[model samples]
Target chain A: MAERAYIMPIALRLWHWTNALLMILLIISGASLHFTDPVIPLIRFDIARTIHNVSGIGVSVLYIFFAVWNSATGSWRQYIPELKGLKANLDRQNYYVFVGQLKGDAPHVVPTPEQKFNAMQQLTYIGVMYIAMPVVIVTGLAFFYPELAPAQLFGFDGLLPIAVLHYVAGFGLTMFLLGHLYMGTTGTTVAGGFRMMITGWHDEHDEKPENEQP
Target chain B: MAAIKTVIWAAIGLVLLTTSAIAQIERKPIAPEDLKNIQDSNAKCLECHSEGGFDTLNREGVDKDKLRDHLVDLGVYEGSNHGRVECKACHVKGFEEFPHAADDKKQINWCDECHTRKFLRIEMQFDESVHAKEGIKEKFTCSTCHDPHVFQAAKYMNSPRDVVRQDNDFCLSCHGSDQSFEQVSKEARPDLVENHEWLPNRPLHWNAVRCVECHTPVSKKVMSHEILPAEKAEKRCVACHSADSTLRLRLYKHMVSEERSRVGFVNSMILNEAYVIGATRNVYLDLALGIFAAVVVFIIVLHSILRIIAAWVRSRRNG
Candidate 1:
């Protein structure tokens, strides 16, 4: 038997794809700008600068809109994991991915409309969306309009710390994206998670594990 | 006897008047032929002036200091931008005599005579400089900072380090040396190193960045000549230490076009020429991040491969 639940909304799907596109553009353009070389130019310097600036602004604006919309619709709850038994739940999820999945065991937790993300996804999403995105956005804007950055920070130029922070946060997001994409394939089917995002419905089979982990 | 004395006095007054009138007249641009003729006439001037020898007729009043000031190194002058300029063009015609006329020293060659239109913007900038202040005007002139005999333009130089050294040398020639300062101002010289003690790595800053970077107001469109006083100099390290440093607008503005053409990392290009503390990139940091990302990708790929293999094995066993 299979059970279906409405997971992603139309608005959320639109925002997700738009944000993904912008992030990809920003990463490519930012890499071009950072490691610019005469012979191995991925993008023209002027063009890369333009793309980075435009995509940065686009993502920043989109994030603000998504934040307000999520708050208003009370959908923000999906990203907030229950603090009670959090460590145990996280441990169980980690066990399923690391050990149980290889032994052909079923997952202990499944997604629903009320709790759309698992414990790990909730924590990772909160960190990336709330912390890393804001840091990178603020730092990116500082680089774009440098005059706004504080003239000094702890005896160093303010931009130096800001540049370092932006690099770290951007790097974290890039790593997270790779992991997130790979994790998407670990659902009921290889393409099940991706199809769920597109169609706004999640389908999970109630099949018992052939070799259950005692 | 009284009539003869009066006549001698009148003739001297008439000669002074004629010399003053000649000094007041501004010379117009001359033809190439005339300029060559005037330059050729400088052979006699160079004979005494080159390599710093004494004036045989006026050796009694001449001291070592005065002789040293008057001496022009022939090689240096020939290499200067003003190498071909006629000596008489600056010093009025009557200087050929054994005892040079008194007014000849005061007969200033206003730089505008030949450099009229080309330097209009620079002339305007000079007008606003601290050196051009009312009381300071009499103490300084173009020659105070720029020794026409040995000056070479910064733009013509290939290396930016050489340009920075040359430009700072112009300021330090007066500010750093007491002997040079005494030639112009009566005020006691301030110690250059002591005044900049508050700055970290003072020598590096002095050599890498130009004195004008701090001493002059920033201007992106053109080089600023409004030299601020020591009290007014930029105190904020962020002014140059920041990624969007004011150095980009002033000192590095000239290199921007070439940097763009090469499409190298902006800070890397700056690092190639000069190492600014916070403005440049860290190779170690970049390498570490690159390795970290590569490891993350490897883990993701490995995990997915193992999971796929497990699923295939389970399906085969169930069937």
Candidate 2:
């Protein structure tokens, strides 16, 4: 791949931060609702519902905008993983994180606009957007209208299965957040990814070309 | 701009006039249609309750949690048999206008208004029965058996399967356990389980001998302005005791209690309460966990498939 530079587009920047912040908020409030503590009720468990509801709207709206921008601008194609070198690149990234960087390696394959995301990032984001979010929303609807649903809640005659599905979706979202937090630290510096998400500008690494054509 | 301002001011004044009329939630005959308009009124009940209330519990932030609290309140309400009665049926003259300043529920008398026959029956029966007639301190009111307002059957556990799942918890509030009934059954007659083998021979299966089998259902249907005397209460004892020895032994070896049921029997009632509640609660927790797990597994599988497809397409394009 040729040396290239691609300043993160403004729309992409906004969507990224909005999605990241909203996901964090969801995990916090969702955790609090399912498992609350005795002390420090910044807001009561009742308000966890409000937080979950409003933040859910925020995340979903941003997701719609992000999807539209990706499709319209044809940037969604960038997520396509290199089938042949996927294992090699993933291993290279892992080695850099673990011990290779300490022993002074060239960090395997160089980062490029064509392959902006590592294999893991592509996989995680795809699942969160397409699968996990819809499950959470549907389960939430189930909890809200258990009686008016396929059946009444107090009776086991029907709708018992929906209730169980609701909890599994909740726990799944919890697991997603935990893994997401661990991956967040893998940027160029100690707090590089955190800084980039906040300001929408990762510190320009000297070795890699900054200018990349779309 | 000047003419538009005048029209806008007039509209604002007219809106307030309409709202003031709607605020009187005590509007009588609170039909289903009225509830929609009531909810749409945009009146914040929390505005006053959170700051000013006779009881601090109904104060600020009260309305925020009121929805969940309503369900919890239903539990307490059922325990008192007030569970059967509707709140507004006794509250204000109308549901919308339910007076916020007082305890409207307890103020209205239940026996004279709703359960006159059962009330009169108690008065007539007590004279010849077990209690010391004059000095019986524990007064049994109309609600002793029937809660005229909120009276409702447990719809969830109204089935045999639901009852069996919960075992005895559903009706434990009124009935005792099987073990408790065993002691009473021994006193009445031995061969407790073995004798009652068929459908009719179950534990605590007392035959209806004296208790009126066919009576009009007593709901809260009060009618005033009639000078005619109300129907008299009836106590037809010996429905089973006097039905002749041969018939009595066929149903029971003779444990008929025209006076009162054998002691340690109320425990059996509580056991039925357990069955319904236990069945419903277990169903909820189980179903909640199951779907929750399935959704997760489904998402994971989908994610893997999508990942493989995306990678394959990319490699083909490159080739």
Q: Which candidate should be chosen as best, given TM-score against the real structure?
A: 1
Q: Candidate 1: where is the Cα deviation over 4 Å?
A: A150-157, A205-214, B1-279
lDDT of 2 by residue, B1-62 (tens): 99999999877763443222111112124566654554333123322322222234453433
Model 2 docking grade: incorrect
Cα lDDT tens digits for candidate 2, A1-214: 4233454656667777777777777767765554433344334454665787788778767767767877887767666666776786577666665555434333343345455666656666667666777777676555544444453222222344453454556566666765565445544443766665555554545556322223
Candidate 2 ranges with C-alpha deviation above 4 Å: A1-6, A36-43, A102-106, A109-114, A141-148, A152-166, A208-214, B1-319
Name the TM-score of chain A in model 1: 0.91
For residues A1-214, write the lDDT of model 1, one tens digit per residue: 7768787889888888899999999989777766655445677555776798899999999999978987998978878888887898788889988988788776666776666777888899999999999999998887765545564443223456678789889989998888888888888778988998899887874654221111
Which docking class does model 1 fall in?
A: incorrect
CA lDDT scores, all candidates in order = 0.72, 0.43
Q: Once model 1 is optimally superposed onto the true structure by TM-score, how far is the C-alpha of residue A140 displaced, in angstroms?
A: 1.0
